[model samples]
Target: MGSLDELIRDLRRFDRRKEVTNALARKVREPVPPVRKKIRKRAIEVLPSSGGFGRWVSKLSITAAVKLQGRAAGIKLKGRRKGFPDKQPKVDLRRIDQGRAAAPSWGRRGEGDWHFQTVTPGFFTETTAEADEWRKAAVSAVDEALGVIRRG
Candidate 1:
């Protein structure tokens, strides 16, 4: 019940509070962990489990701890789903999902002799679709943080 300027300052201060920042981060990250696990599981199922490429690819779902940046909370929704060994970024999940990955032609001794395998497709896409609800939840969380309660 203060002046408009004071109320605006207080709102800004509230937005910058540690608890609020954490809440915002939580909202952003809420969709990630479970989706990550599902993607990992799917990776195990669809991709070959050799050279630990599939395993490392599955490990790409990283949820960093909540961070406050310039009075705003942030988190990244990421997946590399990139490569192997967890250290070196090799392989590309998108290409693989699109059937672009190639396995070395057995008994051949050159990089020129690589063949794309015909495995089941759409593992990443289908599984990721299942987490759509969490996205809506995240949006609603942001709205709530702004004191905008959703009805319906």
Candidate 2:
């Protein structure tokens, strides 16, 4: 019934301008925590810790957020090379992830100067595969958030 300009102005005042955006942001961000936890657990199963520093799995981190611009959301998993700072760690992450023997190292408390056994490659790919469901959840969350915005 209103003019296009009036419709736009009203929409800006009580709806899409902020309420929709905030609701959508919360919705989109909801799946990230569970996904992050699943990823951390999978990392431990896929990556071995027995003969290595056992720290890389613990170092796994996830960062996720919906941008305030109301345009985007993202999830990032972070981890470090075993010998971050470029020194020699008991076993390098890249080497273990690739199913290769660690070059050489002597810092492990009781296992002086040892070669770590090759871990099966694809650990990187498989560990995060469990989170594929997260993408689906995120998509549905957008719909839920839009519905909430409309109801308001």
**Backbone clash count for every predicted candidate, in the order shown:** 0, 0
Please report, in order, the local distance difference test score of every candidate based on alpha carbons: 0.58, 0.51
By summed lDDT, which 10 consecutive residues of candidate 2 come out lowest? Answer: 1-10
Runs of candidate 1 with Cα error greater than 4 angstroms are: 1-23, 49-56, 62-76, 81-89, 107-114, 148-152
Can you list the residue pairs that collide in candidate 2? none
lDDT of 1: 0.58
Residue-level lDDT of model 1, residues 14-128, one tens digit each, is 6345555466667767677777788789877877777564665577655534443445444335455443253334666666666566666774636466677765566677776
Among all windows of ten consecutive residues in candidate 1, which has the lowest summed lDDT? 1-10
Question: What's model 1's TM-score?
Answer: 0.55
lDDT score, candidate 1, position 27: 74
